[model samples]
Target: MTAHIPQSRFAPAEVVTRPQPGTAPTDRRPLWTVIALTAALTGLIMAGYVLTIGTWTVWAVVAMALITLTTLTLSLGAATAVVGLIFPAPRAPRPMPDWQPSSRTAILLTLCGEPPRGPAAMLAELAADLQRAGLDRFVDIFVISDTRDDKAKAEAEALAPLIGSGAITYRRRQENVGRKPGNISDWLDRWGGDYDFMLPLDADSRMSARRIRHLIHRMERSPSTGLLQSGMRLLPAETRFGQLQRSAQRIMGPTFLQGFSAWTGDAGNYWGHNALIRVRAFRDAVPLPKLSGVAPFGGDVLSHDFVEAAWMRRAGWRIEIDADTRASAEDGPQTLAEYHKRDRRWCQGNLQHLRLIAAPGLHPLSRLHMAVGVMGYLSAPLWLATLLLLATGAVPMAAGWMLLAVATLLAAPKLCGVARLMRQARGLRTKGVVLRAAALETVLSSILAPIVMVNHVVDVAQVFAGRDCGWKRPGGASLRLPTGGLEALAGTGIIALVAATNPSAVVWVLPVALPLVFAPLFIRFMEAPCACLMARA
Candidate 1:
């Protein structure tokens, strides 16, 4: 007989009681199926590309092989995600029928120079919702500030008036030691023992009381769950980049989340914010140990959420993302420049995961998760290497069939997402919008790919060189050309080389080269206030 997942303990004097347990959830088939499919597809593409590398230098052949393999690794993930959409798994625990919270929860809101009014307003809204649901007594809010600036600190202080006697509290650390992870650890060390569950939210994160209650209910029903991450819907976007980013997310997020849930199951990862965690489990199992090196890859674990989840899983607790829920929301960056700026820090943090991928007691899938994070940045340099080899005729002309295979591997998952959305639509109206959005996004992504690749390549290099990608709070500055002079000259230089070497290759390489050549102009146009307004219109 299968062992039952542990049931949670409830405190006495609760108004509501428990419900009948529904299902035990013991399926790993979908995860293995996705892995098998990815491997098969990657192998097929690698074989096709290897067969086509005739007449090239051995080094060039090796370079092509490496590129093909790396690219396929990413492709395999996409394919797995598509498979997830097709065979979606239930991410939340079995429905708790008439479940009610049996423990107090603390909503830990982390602040780092964010506009205070925004969060204060969000808190008011959340408080009102909880009071209406009769859960104000069960849940309390904590604003943990890590702001170093005086003005920002004062701004955070202004939020104190919004807090009542005990339901809401505010505290700020004078020195932000390890950025966000450190800030969180500081709070956990001091006040974590007082609460049974802790729900961490970013400054921009928002969720309804009902949704929050549902999450707590799910957690209380499953004692083994260490984390319950909600998939947040992006709030309204006032700028062009934000509009496109959120639109793309709406179209593709579900399918991707479904696949992710399928593979990760109870061993899922965290996305930092908008997630509920068991206080005791987190405080006990996931104490982040400082690595023994310098900046970027060593010092503080920049990407601590993944590692924390790994540790929790190692200690026999479940970490899950409930994508089926839709009440949680957060803001996306309004411009491409802001997005890339955030990604710069993310790049460093993800690269830092290389140090912990081999940490003892971590599960195999958890190791794969960290390895994938490392590849996310490394793939850019590999792509650039492949392009340089092909552009300089160091490699023989890539066969049409091989290129087609590569395209299929890269594009098929996106097409599948679009197809899935269209099929699920209730009317022609949504279908039309989705089709337009998908096509537009596809074109935009192609245009932006090379520029982002170059950016990541630079970031990864800097990271390895021990560059400090410190804390940067978003929404502080307006968009300007993040990539301009040097990038433009480099793009032109590459274009010139391609033209002089092989004019026939110009068309194939032009799209990748143009964004670099006109980096400032592209950034300016894409981020101009008018363009964003027009996109919204």
Candidate 2:
């Protein structure tokens, strides 16, 4: 309900110039029609795939079984998720005090392979926010840059003027040690004792002064806690893509957060970036074990954050989430490609956690958290495989059963989310708008699944290969919307063909057939950003 305009005081303090308007919101209804048609077509393809399956084809049945089962699980999960109310709580943070902090606090802004000017803007914003709250000197800030790139190094040097101003301590290590974990350790090893608490901010992070004050006040009150993690949500900028992502996240994000918060009870995590940690505890857990010498699971630990949290918990320190902690907001993937590219690396990093879930000394539930992270991305591939299988001709009965189960489970959470959005939008007198958006999103997102899933699969592979997904280098790609229509039609065409094999299913096919026809357009419109920006305009 709390929507912000171009960066405010408690908002993201930086704003770019307005963009020239191109597409109008009124032009979006055709986009919706396109989506509906594609969904109906896709339903046909899927039906064909089911009909092709018979008792004779064993492999086909196996694929159908996996897809059907996974989708069912997904659906069941959806059904249980309440739409608007879920936000993960790390652990209750100590109640912040009304009084100011008596001790000096250090804010550590870790910069590794990020744009040089980026941190300064964030720092300026942070400084302004803090000054507004009247707590500027109570804090000392540092910019910890880990530069393997020459340009990044030069930018770090150029940042020396900011350092001279005494706003933040600037340090660039000669060699990159343990990535982010190493950077934080380097700072603590040298000058950690100078302050009471060291706050770690992300490269794209800009927090409100009020939240920052709240964090410091709480830390002052409770000297026992090692780390306090705040809630993190998406902040995509001005583009159509950005708006849709942000809207979708706000509407459906709470449910996901709630599930995550519930799972992490008592000893939670410090997600490395975007949370505050006790410098003393982090320093004590030094010399983190390297991932075993192997491919994906070997070398420097990509998921060092979770490992560090585990280590902290084992050391008798408590880690918790302050659900009320809205101190900072992160700039989400700015472009579509950027979003997918980042997801690839994340898939890799999280998939690696599957290996260490059983590591010695990890809390019993620690593995569960790690496992859940890994599964989230993995579900994409499983969904993809299910679609491909139902395309092949085989036992119609069993295939139909499996598909029903998978779709039911996987789609459950989203359906619940749809209901939540409907209520919220209705209360705001935007019921008509919200329902239309939901219908459009449901169809298009389904179609876009294949594209996203394929990307995720590639990313998982890259992780195992140790391919570096870092850097801001550019790549050439055709100016193309996704292959939504064709994929949807082909997929649903297969479904329809299968349904035709049995005269009885002909009537049943109508139920799914309509959505499948609209599948392609659905995926296209489902870009959330495009639709949201259009509607907003």
Candidate 3:
């Protein structure tokens, strides 16, 4: 059944309308502080390099410029985390104990070709939670399926009981026109008007009933909030690689999110799933525009969440993130291959944001969000290039202190996060476990970083070559070797070149080089379950 959801009209204009005087003020001070700090750190590092080198060759100048840019990027993250440590977003007030939602919310579970059994179980649990909380009457569940194969039939069969009982409304589209965004848009066009708000969920997404009620209550109280994104924790992981990721997320994610929330304020981002959207605001503001070209940079906006958040913000609706709300969770890829496969898709989508970065009438922060999305992938190539330049001795290596400084900046965020976790650790025994896990994650992540960088560099190249990494279900987490052939080759080539010419520099490069060289072995090691670490995690 369709309801008359009034369409809101918003066009990208040449000039952005300034926020009204009384509208919730965005605190620009933290953002400005991050920018200033990043600039200062970059300048200092560059100056130190020049002073140590005491030379001005053409290659040296180019290397210095690249280092400056890389340093700025690295320092921006560290500075933001430090700022978050100093100025945490105030805790959201707890929902009233007896509060009842006044508005209806539809939870849209968008499924692709993923296994349906897991999602069915999750939905069943969600239903039970909501029912226990007396929220079943206020919320409806919809299974919007984009699965097109025999799996579609299987999915329907799996969810048949839920559908038969009227617990979930199921619809499968024959044509996956716009992919996930299209599936959501289809729902919005049809049933959006009947609900006050919609919660878009990924196949792996899970939210506690308390969190859902909290989000709904917040949305009801704040009339202008078009979207509210909750802080998400990674669900318990089974594989060693997944465990490492989960531990890092558990320890570091909160601090980074707090910093992110502080700086973004009302102009926050949407991570697609596990977020609440005002039905009318999204319907009116977030009409996905098919860009005027081909794959990657054109066609359907692949990374629609950020763009949606941006559009909603531009249309004068507040886009907020409640970092204090931490009950929402999602599953992550369990193996390196699985992780890289997902990253490849994300890489293309984020690269597509390059075209939207300059879209007119966007808030500067919105533009920054898009720019950051673009950089998230592009930074890998930049980092690879910077490493190559430094290793070849094209850039003077006299600045040992410069290397030390860069290392410090790179490690600062993790160190800060660990420190915060330790401070909050209740007992000495608990603190020790946190410290050990933090150290293990740090070391393993260092080994994995180069491999991931090479993969991302390849992903960026494919996008530029007009190759689309089409939406495919991630492979299962089965252990295999030779996962990093390209990484192995790259590392071998670098080491060979260095050993043949500048054998002395090989020692300095071993930390990064060894990881790439032994990537397959490392991948296997990472894939193997470590009971010690998993128990602590």
Candidate 4:
């Protein structure tokens, strides 16, 4: 017998009612402490710049401000890591041997134009996993497609076996209205009320049945919690670039995430996937509104997860992250070009948050969340400008001590991350391996940093110029000569100018300059496979 599905409203809310979750006092001391530390460090760097130069010209002042702003961002990260190290890690939830879900849940796998073989296989495995755990009856799998006719036909074919056995249902939308978020909304409008919860998974997202059960159990216990985000680790990678990223995430990601969770508390942000969402709460609170303008800033929100999280918080439901959930994972970009391509879309989406920072009724922390998102991308341009200002002799080179201080501040988080890993190591051999991997990851990441900075600067500039980074799949390992050439030119110019004008500054500029000059080679290197780096450790 076909069960009748209750439809839910899809209209955007004109006004938010008072939050049903009462305003319990959240301890924000850690947040304030981090803010104060960032400000103090920024001030110290600015003061050192003034003392070193012995004069404050207009250019010097502007450069100082930009440098300090970038320094502040870096310091905030270091401070968060320090805080993370201070706080003991959150304990993972205990397993419930006799637990059974009292409410229905759905697993939503949102698809675009990607090939379906992998995701179909993943879903099949997931279904099998759930059956093994004896929880398949309480959950349903939905393959939501936003692909064109060609891709949709392929997806239907690939998913045919699963559908035929009633293990999964496939649905394709005629219009890709709001992109991924729109696809989810369409699902909610049709069958949202029939399910108590929904676990949204991206095309690349993977979670085990045990992890899914853990998240559901957490949600079932916390009635006021609207969104429960799992800690996502990177899947093992084949390319050096992917390996570096995975290793870094494996090593350093935990402390940062722990600090972030401590600071945000119940008003945490969301990453749009691998999260358990209370269907009724999401339906009531997160019907995304179309912004009044056009692409980029206007129309549908590109970075909808954070905004939906903000809206969910405004409507008075707890949004939390359980960093201890280690079973959830996702694939990462395998090459520098692919990384930048994905980053460009994120850069555009984050920039869109600028318009909504001061939207009515948002919690202060939610507003801060949006501001943080905007600043994360904008920091790239600020950093690029600082480097350019130094190269042009607009600002005098920083004093040796000042430079050392800045480097230490930037490297502090990595040091803390490494330290934590070493402490957790059981044997001398394991610690030695951890140290070697850390050293290699550091060197490679330092070389890659400037390239990323330049890419981000271009992304920010293009976004402001109304260039829309449309929803497109990340391209394969193809060299972009234009991007590489631009980097090479910028690096060569910076080095030549600095060496000719201020010979002493050449050393300081080498880190940024050399990478830019050799960007094409570095890109190629990153695209090649290397298993010896941190990922192997």
The lDDT per prediction is: 0.74, 0.58, 0.81, 0.81
TM values, all candidates: 0.89, 0.72, 0.92, 0.92
Candidate 4 residues lying further than 4 Å off, grouped into runs, are 1-19, 23-29, 397-402, 472-483, 533-535
- Looking at model 4, the pairs that clash are none
CA RMSD of each candidate after superposition: 6.5, 12.5, 5.3, 4.3
Give stretches of model 1 more than 4 Å off.
1-25, 89-99, 164-167, 399-403, 472-483, 530-537
Question: Alpha-carbon error at 206 in model 2, in Å?
Answer: 2.0
Give candidate 2 regions above 4 Å deviation. 1-80, 83-97, 102-104, 148-150, 157-161, 219-224, 325-327, 393-411, 415-428, 462-537
Give the Cα error of residue 73 in candidate 3, in Å.
2.1
**Candidate 4 lDDT trough over 10 residues, lowest sum:** 1-10
TM-score of 2: 0.72
Tens digits of per-residue lDDT, candidate 1, 334-428, equal 87667778888888888888788998989888898888888888888887777767766667766345456656766766777787788887798
lDDT: which is higher, 2 or 3?
3
What is candidate 3's TM-score against the reference?
0.92
Q: Which digits, one per residue and each the tens of the lDDT, describe model 2 over residues 224-268?
A: 566777677765465555655565665556564454344343456
User: Model 2, residue 283: displacement in angstroms?
Assistant: 2.8
Tens-digit lDDT track of model 4 for 129-154: 99999889788888888888667777
